[model samples]
Target: MHIAAQAYGRTSKTGLPTRELEATLLSQSAARLAAARDRRADDFALVVEALEENRKLWSLLVRASSAPESELPDALKQNVAKLGAFIFQKTIDLIENAEPEGFTALAEINRNIAAGLRGIPADA
Candidate 1:
């Protein structure tokens, strides 16, 4: 299955929306988690699968945020790095104590970030 090609919407010749990749990734992760939860059949590795994809996403953000040439403000980069670190630690925690409860926050975070990426102004 070609997930990247089919899962997310097609990219225009000009370019995708800012943070579209992150949004698409989060959308897929959310769907995966939902499907895993909905499964009547055994879902032996769902936690690992969902968390791993999310972990990779956050890792990419951390790397991008902290890059020396990154145009993002220092404070924003620091904040993102902190959140990335928290996500990393939480990934381990969820692995050790796997449950659906831990999944909500991660999904919400992704959704919220994706919302921001869509150019919605956040409330102060």
Candidate 2:
């Protein structure tokens, strides 16, 4: 997925609202990570692939949020950047350790962010 092409709060070429597109992407990534974690014993490669995809998504979000042209408030931008850094570190740790519990945090973070983008509560 060329997530870099999808700008937040705008309509994308696919006609979906970019916010919704982002939410969908996050949700999908979360699902993939969760599934891969569950099946890691069967195919560890799936976990690696899912983690890579999630890292790419977070890279796009961190870059966009940190861009000078971004409309996000400084606090929000900083928070997102911090979260991205954590995500990146966690991804590396999981890649090296292959711990199933590590995937849980990543999936939860994606789900919470997706819910926020959709204007819904994370626990909903």
TM-score of each: 0.76, 0.89
Q: Looking at candidate 1, what is the lDDT of residue 116?
A: 76
RMSD of each: 4.1, 2.5
- Which ten contiguous residues of candidate 1 have the minimum total lDDT? 1-10
Model 1: per-residue Cα lDDT over 13-51, one tens digit each: 537653777677767776765565454136648767777
What is the alpha-carbon lDDT for the whole of candidate 2?
A: 0.87
Which candidate gets the maximum TM-score versus the true structure? 2
Location of the lowest summed lDDT over 10 successive residues in candidate 2: 1-10
Measured with C-alpha atoms, the lDDT of residue 36 in candidate 2 is 85
Candidate 2 structure quality by residue, lDDT tens digits, 5-124 = 444434544698767887888999999999988988888889889999899889988997899899999999999999999999999999888788899999999999999999998678
lDDT for each candidate structure: 0.70, 0.87
Cα TM-score of candidate 2: 0.89
The C-alpha stretches of model 1 lying farther than 4 A from their native spots are 1-14, 37-41, 121-124
